[model samples]
Target: MGIIGINRSPSCGVDITSKNDQEVAGEGVFIEILRKKLEKNISIDMVGIKVLEIEKALIDIQRLINTK
Candidate 1:
């Protein structure tokens, strides 16, 4: 399964999580926990979405679905 999250959120960001108003390259706490918990059962592919990149995100999601 795949998850789409906001890029600027602290709790739900996938690739650009927020930290003290700075953008960092990391996953959110929940994503970290979920990854470990579901590592054995399912393939998890996550992507960060930005408001400005909605079109790109959609394309990425389509590609993910096609591959699966």
Candidate 2:
């Protein structure tokens, strides 16, 4: 129903990603690809969080689940 990724990851980021040493706003490679693949059949929500902020990430996941 939802997807969660680490922010600033080159392959999994959802909101922030490292590009040539600078952080930019965009989805990472994998998430972007997955999104495109899913765009045709579903409307899943995706979110990103810092790795150290696992607690917040859990809350985000809960929210994603609740929206269903």
Candidate 3:
């Protein structure tokens, strides 16, 4: 299974997360934990979903699904 998260969240964003009102490129808290917990499995994909970039997110999700 895969997981999708909001890209603008401070704790859940996967790529473009907000920090002090400024956007930064990095992983969020939950993602970090999940990664550490699921490091043994490489087939599970994780992606970030952006509100403004819905089309891109959809495409990414589709790709993830196709991989599985």
TM-score, structure 2 vs. true: 0.87
How should the candidates be ordered by lDDT, best one leading? Answer: 2, 3, 1
Assess every candidate by TM-score.
0.82, 0.87, 0.82
lDDT of 2 by residue, 1-68 (tens): 78888899988999998899788999899999999999999888998988889899889889988998
User: Which stretches of model 1 miss by more than 4 angstroms?
Assistant: none
Model 3 / residue 53 / CA error / Å: 1.7
Q: What is the clash count of model 2?
A: 0
For model 2, give the 10-residue run with minimal summed lDDT. 15-24
- Candidate 3 segments exceeding 4 Å error: 40-43
lDDT of 3 by residue, 1-68 (tens): 78888887888887767888888998778887877788876646788999788789889999878887
Worst window of 10 by summed lDDT in candidate 1: 59-68
Clashing pairs in 2: none
- C-alpha lDDT score of every prediction, in listed order: 0.80, 0.90, 0.82
Q: Please give the lDDT score at residue 29 for candidate 2.
A: 96
Error of 1 at 54 (Å): 1.5
Which segments of model 2 are wrong by more than 4 Å?
Answer: none
